[model samples]
Target chain A: MGNRTPLYEEHLRANAKMVDFGGWDMPINYGSQIEEHNQVRQDAGMFDVSHMTIVDLSGDKVKPFLQYLLANNVDRLKDKGKALYTCMLNEQGGVIDDLIVYYLGETFYRMVVNAATREKDLAWIEKHAAAYDVTVNVRDDMAMIAVQGPNARDKAHKVLGVAIADQLVDIKPFFMREMGDVIVARTGYTGEDGYEIMLPANQAPGTWRQLVEAGVKPTGLGARDTLRLEAGMNLYGHDMDENTTPLESGLSWTVAWEPEDRDFIGRAALARQKSEGVKRKLVGLVLEDRGVLRDHQKVIVDGEEAGEITSGSFSPTLGKSIAFARVPASVGTHCQVDVRGKLLNARVVKLSFVRNGKPCIDV
Target chain B: MSNIPQELRFTKSHEWVKREEDGTLVIGITDHAQQLLGDLVFVEVPEAGSSFKDSDDCAVIESVKAASDVYCPVAGEVIESNEALADAPETINNDPYGDGWIFKLKPEDEGAYDGLMDADAYAEVVAEDEH
Candidate 1:
């Protein structure tokens, strides 16, 4: 048996096929994954993402503590409700977990980390906070639901009522605002304009039902995977992990290094790698052959092993199979993905295969 | 009516075999197999002239999520294959027992279907797997 979310009964009512995801039984798909993928890309869809862990950091020392804890600078979040996406690193410069931190006030900040890495993340936050006057508090009482699409913000507001929904227009990207008890953030994982709502667990089911009744289609994890892939966002366990670093995982841009005096946990290791140059680099792959690109397949570049795919899937938006591969930094435009022992040619392009429902490459 | 047909036989791996009157056998992945694979995206059937032993990898069904191999339910030469699936593989999801059939084979031996499970047995197997 696995843990069930507050909306599990609602998912069952909608005939969602449940799958065990990190000990939590959740919906993989409501019916057709492809259809649900299109709904989010074309219209509106909501996802129950409460399985992700949330923690609150407090005290006047919160800002300083986060500066030493995360790879990205916390000072970038100058305004209240501003959010910053960053990766927490180990001493060896390997990524421990990637998370989004929301700056709420002078003494408090909120963070949502991956479910599988919750234990380590909590431990790391606590262990590092001991030197400062900060306190680490986990927010297990909140349930999060993400409504994403071009019209997602509009629909979510209409369903929640015009008075509350009207405030959504002013919530800029990577910013959040609280409406009554709901923490509505203008953020999303699907590379679309929308909001991620966080509320009490007991209120989640009713809120989900209300949103669904207001014409927001219920989406599942299957669509979530493909949508994130199409958006060029990395999956926690697949695209990168404890053994991988942000520099080699196409997330180098997220790192902040300016003041020579500011020493983060993995600063020295990353600084050394930065000076010496990185060995492997993560790049996007586009198939030119009749076959699809898949993960764990050997990537032959110039008839030699360049790298293997970290995450691969058939993109619903592009109608083709694409992948993210960690290849040699020197590897160029042409590569071959071995599928079923045969090398299928693929072209290496910059990441973000599909953005805002359009192809980044010229097809 | 959507259960495995009584006239056909099944393997433990979930392939269905329909032995024709002329000794030619029609082969396909069972409906249970298609359901497990989710939405079909591509089908890689064997060449018509290729011969295979029972339980050999004779075909492949690629879904939007994953790829699975379709084994030869009965050993024989593949006399014909359903090429219609190459353009649109969703037929397998819509009609797995009929239009979604993969290949036709002439059995090398008459007792090829004898060792396979009956329709009732295959249905029971699917039911048990649902747990």
Candidate 2:
């Protein structure tokens, strides 16, 4: 048995296939995974992201504390409700977790971390905060839901009412606004226009039912993974882990290097790595053959094992297979993947396979 | 409960076998099996003229979640393989019984086919596992 979110009963009512995801009994899909993936690309879809951990920080020195905590500079979040995507690193320059931090006020920020890395992330944050005067508050009573697609904002506004909808439409992307107990943010993992709503857990079930009635199809973890992959978003445990650095994980852009004196936690290690030259690079792969590419498959470059795939799947939008591989820096645009003892041809492209409901690379 | 056609024979591993009028045996995964595996992304059928023993793993079927092996119910040589699935594997999900047939086998011994379980028995096997 595992923990169930507030919408567990709703998922059951929709005939969802339940699976244990990172110790939470979450829905893998309501029905067909491909259909759910397509729905988010072409129309509106809702995902219960309540299993993610939310931590609120407040203090006189909260801004400076965040500057030394995250890899990206929080000093850039000058406007209220501005959010930044960054990696939290350890002393060894390895990722503790990737998170989104929203600056709500001068002394307050709301952060969301991955569900599987919740405990470790909290401990790291708390330990680092002891030196500063910041207070770390975990809001377990809050539930999150992400509604995403081309028409997602309109559908979400219809369910959330007119005033809130009007305010949400005016909010810029990667920005959020608080309305009573609900926080509506124009952020999404599916690379589509939508909002990620966080509200009291007790009020979640009713809101979910209303969204369903508004014709926002219910999606689950399976479709979420495919959608994120198509958008070229890096999953925490899959694309990188504690032992992998941001430089090797296609996350160098997330690290802020300006004002060299920022003196972040992993700054020294990253500086040392950069001077010595990074060894590996993350690249996207599209299988030109008839088989599906999968994780941990050996990547053959010039007839030798040069790398391995971190995430791979069939692209529902492209009607082919694609993957993310961490290969040697010298590897070229063409390589072969060893699938079940057969070497198949694949083409390397930019990090993302699809973006904004369209193919980012050639089909 | 999934649809279990009464006339076809079944294996505990979820493969369904049907004997053609020409004495060749046609095989595919059962509806219950395809439903459990979700959408099919790839299917690797055995090449024609290949031989296998009873209960031998002869083919590979993959979904987005995991991969599963389809075993040969009876010892036989492959007569025809379903090449159409190579381009569009979702046929197994759309029509798991008729157009989704995986392959045809020339059985080494006709009696070996009788040793497999019937539709009702296979249904019981699936039902017991669900609990």
Candidate 3:
């Protein structure tokens, strides 16, 4: 009863368990979620990310417009195809949405934002672009597929054929290359080496089938959540929202404050918060006992509620439970999580638990 | 269609009960229930000798997707709890009717097992839910 992506039929053919995700009926998993998670970590896997929104911004003032609009400096993208991950902030220093912008040309840039935040993001971009005369084009005719893992690139290259593969040989991480009508970016949400391919919507099913034939296992949104959580990536609406700033959401590194004169939106508020010091901070938690860490669980420090978990789940790779909690800056390494009326012991760790199919933290 | 053993009795909530020759009852979640919960990672079974009323929330099953409560089908005292599931919770997903049984219970009323839904009736419940 919801919106269906270009690959919806393919998902049904694969016996995927479909669920409503941000207004689109997408696959939660094909069969076992843990199996799909392990497949992506150990070998190659493909995901139907066609529901994501793609926008193209163009005009002579595009560069300057982005400089004022994004929290991260757009000047850092010096080369063509280079991508920068940044947060678009409101006037009050709250994060509107986080996105990746790729430098295509002097007057043109491509952006991929979260699907749920598409309408608001487009409205905000258009509202600010009027003064700069930048044109915004939403590419609804496109579909995206992400192929990930250690063997992901090789498997994807096999499906893309020799000519397209040859053009991507020199592609670096966070860089994109256009092969005829397709744009392949060496980037992905999963903490693995992969490419997120964007092409015509009608060609998505064929491309997905080709990748599957090449032995890339089809993954779903369930595995994507666990993989991204292990990668220490912040999911929109969960880790942070329009009410929270990037500084408090463990995303301080994404803010570019190098050019003190560059007065981007929310710069003054963030500067004030920086000078005053941020009281609350986001940190990672590893359950020391046998239990699953879930979202909205209260984080108890010394028998008092100090914070709450923003995102939590069982880590298939680690064989343990992990979570992201926003606690007082003074909270120590040890805390307890209120899991269904029981306070279980937990140890605080760095943001990431796994990377490159290996454990980043001590098990 | 999900596997529904003809010898077993079921509750509307998907718990299956099998009356043993000794009057003790073995209970577990149905195949349809495990399929709905996805891969089970953690299970909290009732302790042996624990008493519960009918329809009481007595056990917990946590999957990668969400945590679900296993309700007590009838008023009974637990005779034994399956401890193996603490280490291998996916046993329920693999063999829901046999080795994945959660607990053995001695019902308070001798005729309580007969009051539960039969295999054919439980099939109708599952069919109604699929829509």
Best by TM-score: 3
Q: Score the docking of each candidate (DockQ).
A: 0.58, 0.78, 0.89
Among all candidates shown, the one with the greatest lDDT: 3
For model 1, name the residue pairs that clash.
A157-A165
The 10-residue segment of model 1 chain A with minimum total lDDT is A160-169
Residue lDDT tens for model 1, A297-318? 8899999987999988788787
The candidate 3 chain A region of ten consecutive residues with least summed lDDT is: A44-53
**Looking at model 1, what is the TM-score of chain A?**
0.98
lDDT string for model 3 (A194-283, tens) is 999999999999999999999999999999999999999999999999999999999999999988899899999999999999999999
lDDT for each residue of candidate 3 in B28-49, tens digit (9 for 90 to 100): 9999999999989889999998
Give the local distance difference test score of model 2.
0.92
lDDT of 3: 0.95
- Measured by DockQ, the strongest candidate is 3
Candidates in order have lDDT scores of 0.88, 0.92, 0.95
Model 3: per-residue Cα lDDT at residue A234:
97
